[model samples]
Target: MTETLAETTPHSDEPIPAYPMPRASGCPFDPPPAAQALHDELPVAKVRMWDGSTPWLVTRYGDGRALLADPRVSSQSTLPGFPHPNAGFRENAERRRSFIAMDDPEHARIRRMVTAPFAIKRVEALRPSIQKITDELIDGMLAGPNSADLVSALALPLPSLVICTLLGVPYEDHEFFQEKSSLMINRYSSAEDMIGASDALTDYLDELIGVKLAEPADDMLSELATRVGSGELTRREAASMGVLLLIAGHETTANMIALGTVALLENPDQLAVLRETDDPKVVAKAVEELLRYLTIVHNGRGRVALEDIEVGDATIRAGDGIIIYTGTGNRDPELFPEPDRLDIGRDARRHMAFGFGVHQCLGQPLARVELQVVYGTLYRRIPTLRLATGAGQLPYKHDGLVYGVYELPVTWDA
Candidate 1:
């Protein structure tokens, strides 16, 4: 590893750019210009984190994929130098420890218990149910008014409904969980707020599992309750898993749907590809392209090094923290030509929108299917859906751990 001592280098005494440098004025759909600059200029160098720690920021596409899969790198949040997603998560790392924060063996053990529900085949089987849910939501939207906020009408509720049915959680309680989930997902949320939300959801899930224990249902939560009964999992553990699934199951995909819709509306040339097509293959291609173009998980994936590893021109040492900017990596020109352009016709299955290792999104299959349904049906069904407000006026979730729009005001001709 040839170490360089540039002004932005992590090891140098010179000034270093902050981990989440601000996004440029006009490019809301892209990563922060400063961070994306590192993708090409200093792909494997350190950057100052919020806590004043310097963690290696892996920005290049190849480097990010290599490090994420590297055995010497670990995802355990309990580790001292681990780069947590936010201050709240950092403060409560120990208490919030779930399989996602653990490395291999243990991670594999706990993750497998819930894998059956998200398996590709099982997820595919739910297409009809998902399609039905999507159609019903669109029906409600079309019948109600000429204009509606797409986030509340379609994006947020669709996944919430689907996940609720799968997890045996009542859709009537979505507001409670949605409010709690929002607090937890906001990157700048106070430690107390995040902790409070986590505790509330955990308690709620615990009680729900108790019901499943007594009156078993044919849902994922019932399976978890059975595990608790068999002494395979603790009641608390089951509840924690429930919290993760419920939050992750909706939040991430919801953003993609709303954000993707906004991006498509802004790019009429791209929107035409979807509105004019009934082919599932065409819709699936569009989903991948949108996933890559938007790349909603823009904060970057964090990990800690377990041992010394040489990357590009830098040697990440043991105990050092790492943050892989996968969202920017998806825009790597080397991997995808004209990467910045959203080309639905291009084969984009190789994009790292979901990520590239063991911790890649577990609900990716379900998310893809949902997006495919929405992209295939929504525009074609209405054939006139358009943004009611200017894109610049919409509030984007730049402060949250996820990247999305708060409200997507859209209308269609009746």
Candidate 2:
């Protein structure tokens, strides 16, 4: 069952195939025969990258998990002397230190501070507010004319509101800060634009942090500030986490809400099943399936070989960089049977969509709750939800690392 890259094929002079076009590029979600071919014949092969350099893409489920859990591998984007895709985007790599980009003792200490607050129990306590927010968004969707952009009307706003509530951000100022955050995440934007947005977001967070220090509320930001004041966390650490919560809380979920609706609309039978069920457990299962089906964050986790290590017959020498393609690993046939299908109860709990090991997504609990509320409410509230564009004409992200639709148009009877 377990196979290594050397067992299949070794490095070759023949040119590696161009990166496979994502299903988000208007094809079906099934992994192309070409991709699966690579998975089988060369579980780990160097592929031509967008930047004209080659990066090893790990496709087999076991190899991906092994690499993800390996201590020699790191999440740091700025590992000195290693080839990185982000080399152009970052200047003085030491300047940026995202928690996701940190390793070991530092990552452990900072993560411990926020773990309890993001735990399922703490997130469940916000159910009433989340439900109320969902209802309000549904009301707005109904109030609009029959045809509306579901993304702008609901998907985008719902996550923003929920994150604001969690962080105690004033709802009134969300629009301004959310725009700044969006600009930072949209990779298509120029390097200058990204840097500007990052500065603007940091400035905005500093302002909010100042306010929280003065009038501490029962919010995460307030709690972070309290920790900082008590010398538990540095001001820089507190600021970084605040920005991370805001960005991660919204960007990924916004895509899920937008793209998941597209998937359900494509399969009306599944939509019917979900619409008829009001049970939280059922909705939760459906959310997992949708996450698997959408596979929005196509980009993989980045790692480097600190020393020579043998992986599946291939010895990656010290300083070689690798990327564990999580999206590919989640859909490996050996892991999920009929990997392309969207079966809500397919028992896909093993999926790495939220990733695995110590670096698993910290905000996963909140994301799950948001999806359940949004999807459960959408179908029940709008029994006639359908795509406004023709099936073949729906717009989707073609080349982004995180694949999602540019717009999700939908119509429903009021």
Candidate 3:
């Protein structure tokens, strides 16, 4: 039912718009207007990337979902024509092959080892501990300065503490790992810088895995170490898994906590809905709505075509690069009514914020519980919580893999 490029653009002479288009300053939460415009006219259009490769930029919700779930589309970055986010990602794509970048069977094998700890039931069981951490952080915030940077005070450290405890990694060494993670995900980092960061984290994890092997504990790392000892996984493989979980566990959730707080503060109507809601179901729905409104992973998920696949109005040829723009997809009008508006009551469970198919986030349950507890607890405890600065004045993480506020300055009544 889709049209090929030959049919749609035989006489086209206009240059394709570049990818990673800037969001309109007036509407920082929305996806780039230029990209959204593409969804209106041509849901699947070609865009040149940083590396000068023209990949199909899928903007339609249905098309993005189809491509993401299709086996013909691959997530493997090592493929010759894979669409790497930047020079830095391209340089280290093959070197750091976490389960995220691998195909089925191989990806499934390693993902299984860590899946049990993150299952919905398991993650739900940690809610009490997570709630305790959130309260403690908020208490510290209240006891200290009237005005504080939420990123350092509550947003960043809460997740850092949780992930560190879960992985059995020392929280005292957060600075080292956090710096390496920042370098690894920064858009402007050089190839060498990315490789160096990867190596440093890998080396650190390798040593930690050694420690866990000798002195086993009741933690995710200890489980991985047991696998290594039993010859089910190599030491290097175990270490790589540790690095992936450590970085991913904290970074996404931390950003969500900070950015979600800002978004709620900016939209008072929506904020009221969350503040007044005591029902767990309502809080859970609000979390999904926030996830959809701010699809924080601004960078499109990249893939290479294993075989020719037709989607929407284009035939993706084998070796063609593809970038599924989930940010735009989440806002597609067809998927959600008034897609631009953040409606807490809407059923947004189908949103691609954590992606779709087998590659959907492994830690989503944990993230959901964390957000539910924080959003439910933070506003109730601090009813007057509001942003200290204008939303436009705040700096955003446009240059990083994940989209979020760098420092959310907030104030509430004492």
C-alpha TM-scores of all predictions: 0.96, 0.91, 0.96
Q: List the residue pairs that clash in candidate 3.
A: none
Relative to the true structure, how large is the alpha-carbon lDDT of every model?
0.89, 0.76, 0.89
Q: Which of 1 and 2 is the better model by lDDT?
A: 1
Candidate 3, 75-132: lDDT as tens digits: 8999988988888788777777889999998889989989998888888888999999
Best to worst by lDDT, what's the order? 1, 3, 2
What TM-score would you give candidate 1 relative to the actual structure? 0.96
Model 2 ranges off by over 4 Å: 1-11, 17-25, 28-35, 81-89
Residue ranges of candidate 1 with Cα displaced over 4 Å: 1-14
The lowest-lDDT stretch of 10 consecutive residues in candidate 1 is 1-10
Residues 259-315 of candidate 1: C-alpha lDDT, one tens digit per residue: 998888888999998999888999999999999999888888889999999998898
Clashes of each: 0, 0, 0
lDDT of 2 at 352: 80
- Cα error, candidate 3, residue 402 (Å): 0.3
Q: What is the lDDT of candidate 1?
A: 0.89
